[model samples]
Target: MDAATAWLVAAVSLLAAVVGPFAAGHALLTKREPQVATAWIAVCLIFPAGGALLYYLFGINRVYTRARKLVAEERLPPSLAPHPTSSSHGIGPEYAEQIRISDAVTGRPLEPGNRIQVLSNGEEAYPVMLEAIEGARETVMLSTYIFETNTSGRQFIDALSAAHRRGVDVRVLIDGVGEYYTWPRPSTLLRRAGVPVARFLPPRLIPPQLSINLRNHRKILVVDGQRAFTGGMNLGDSHLLQSQRSHRVADVHFLFDGPLAQQMEAVFAEDWAFTTGDERTPPKRATPHDSGALCRTITDGPNEDLDRLVMTLIGALSAAREEIWLVTPYFLPMRPLITSLEAAALRGVEVKILLPERNNLPFVHWATRHILGELLHWGVHLYYQPPPFAHTKLFVVDRRYAQVGSANMDPRSLRLNFELNAEIYNRPIAEQLALDCELIRARSRQLSSAELGERHPAERLRDALCWLASPYL
Candidate 1:
């Protein structure tokens, strides 16, 4: 072919690549959040190849949707969800009512009276979780987005393996991609040891092309249908050691007893039923503890027909009486969230946000700065958690309610990824969470207009370019 003919052929092929999915993406009848739809359109327009790549990477596929339809077609028995006993503590009336609505919507009650404990980092959470697994009697259910079969992951494997051998009804779930070469097949090892493990939304067995975007991003652990844990902590060596690895992630996890733990178990049951089809009639077990805290679990995913994280933040911020505090590894907020944060500060609601000084994704870190400048101007106090990549995501409101989990304040998470979080409304737990925020504050400094202006022109341009591509990040 001549040079002119070759150029025309190349142009035609590129057009087909963009137009095909762009048309299918809109035409498909799958449920999507309004913000996600808007962002998807923006992503397609800005960079065609990049958008196509993202659409393939995290985009929804028809197979899973069809599988869901097939499952819905079957007549399944009622999976028993007996409520757990409550502890001796309940939150104030205002917070309690929100719990009621969440309970109704989620079909899981907040055990009003429960003892809550905060595990500062992996060093604390790891041992506690292992102990919980060690004590499991009826069931030991665990799910994580990233489960490296590395050295650290192996310890968890050993623990779970021991639990399985002890006649504990053990079930483990890991994301197919998150455990990709960096880790080995945890499920395979468990299978060899006669334990049951399933990959949530595993890659399609038939067609390799369909394995692109589907992932189970939830990180949760519930033991014996009683005690439970959830947060950013994944099973890995980096979470334990300051590591020789490229980027060490700092994360937080929670240990729950009382009604909230039951709520977490319910969340696990849903994923378990979806993955294994082992809808065994589980027992009604809720151990009431002495800690006074009101807690509920909230699960979000592409399957959920709403933006749970963004809505929860906006609702909490709008209803704030005195203060609001937040922390996340990624700081890119969509338009509605940005506006909500700005309005909360403008109304004299003490608003503070903590993000990592050095995020694992540097491109995203740079992109988050431009629009974030607008927040600082609106009196939204911004603090950067110093060193070691703070991966914790937290939200506290009015000294009463707080949420902690794996979801970050970024488009990729708020819109695309599946995540799990717990909303707590007990004074002592709230205070403890607030104290954790302050420790991050002690290490982080406030950003000023002066510092933003002092950036080198080259740095500014780099940030600006990345900001334009924020939808994909």
Candidate 2:
């Protein structure tokens, strides 16, 4: 062989040796999970060049770094800072422990005097929300994951445009990836209508920040800083069950008025600032109501706030004495959550989880089946609500405490995507949500160990494979 060809081969070998160990060392020092680190290390060493490329493309988490930097540099507007401690007036002695746990999990105080109304679907929620937007005299802020430019989406665009024309301070934030659901994107229409709109983490070639994960899955709408609407419902016609017909998605949204609205607005302000780097002064705080419930906002994401929601959930579960009711579309919970569920059931706390019979994502549904037998073995009750695919997410404990928001039980919602939830202390609202869970349960079929075992061998294998990939799903 020529000396030139021999030199090229030696240079390539030296480069691979350097790259493989460098990538493997980064993974070993940074990865939180031992299994994940070992797998990446093995891959990097086994294939050398190809493994290094793959690790560069997918193994490193840029989302966490960017998010942490942004959070560290920018702080929430001063007007929205939490009080010294949670309010103890309306809270009872029984819930003192839960309050303390939440206080530590999230450094926010329990805002009292919040009036909450559970709206069943978009059909019930949209009209009132639009009415509030129409009457807005000061500011209007909205952030949603999906903003389809369909019939329902057009109405919102029109309303927001009109509000902007009236000299109201209006801002709209739509998820970067979720804006592509339809042609002539909602961002395009909003901008054309002279509304100030921004997309959160849009991927492009110029600057090149491309990630399919790390989505902003939060849904929030605050009108005039006096009332807000939030929950699992997205802004699209699909949520309007009666009108959507074949493509209907059943979900629940909450209409809230009082100090909680300001807390919701605070969260919006934080996101808006993060997206645009413009932290305007927040609007005036709403007058505290005479009588209402205590509420606190819990924000979770892949950065500084990682694992907060799950920790808060575990805290609530540990504090439960009587019953726990949970409903969500996805069910790929992390190991810690699984252990918590088992412990809750073993403690004789009536633990019930409601999930959709047919999920929009079939892989998640199949993966969920693989863990059913374990939960059933531990006395946890599971139910599958009949179709149209319920998109509601809620957690009610002891008929006196509840958590409502856009976060689901899956890894995507818990650890990757940005999420928002509210811890509520009110018997009436919690009892109402528990009643709704009961209604869904009545119409649903109980999932038993026998049913899970009846699956064919091939089906079981498919589910096992899916379960193995649950962390990514």
* Candidate 1 lDDT, 399-461, residue by residue in tens: 678888878888777765777888887777787888888888988898887788889999999
Clashes of 2: 0
Clashing pairs in 2: none
Candidate 1 regions with alpha-carbon error over 4 angstroms: 1-91, 96-107, 209-211, 241-246
TM-score of each: 0.84, 0.93
lDDT of 2 by residue, 46-77 (tens): 98888987777667666557765456244432
Best by lDDT: 2
Assess candidate 2 and give its lDDT: 0.87
Please list the Cα RMSD from the true structure of every candidate, rounded to 1 decimal place.
Answer: 5.1, 3.0
lDDT of 1: 0.73
Q: Evaluate residue 55 in candidate 1 and report its C-alpha lDDT on the 0 to 100 scale.
A: 56
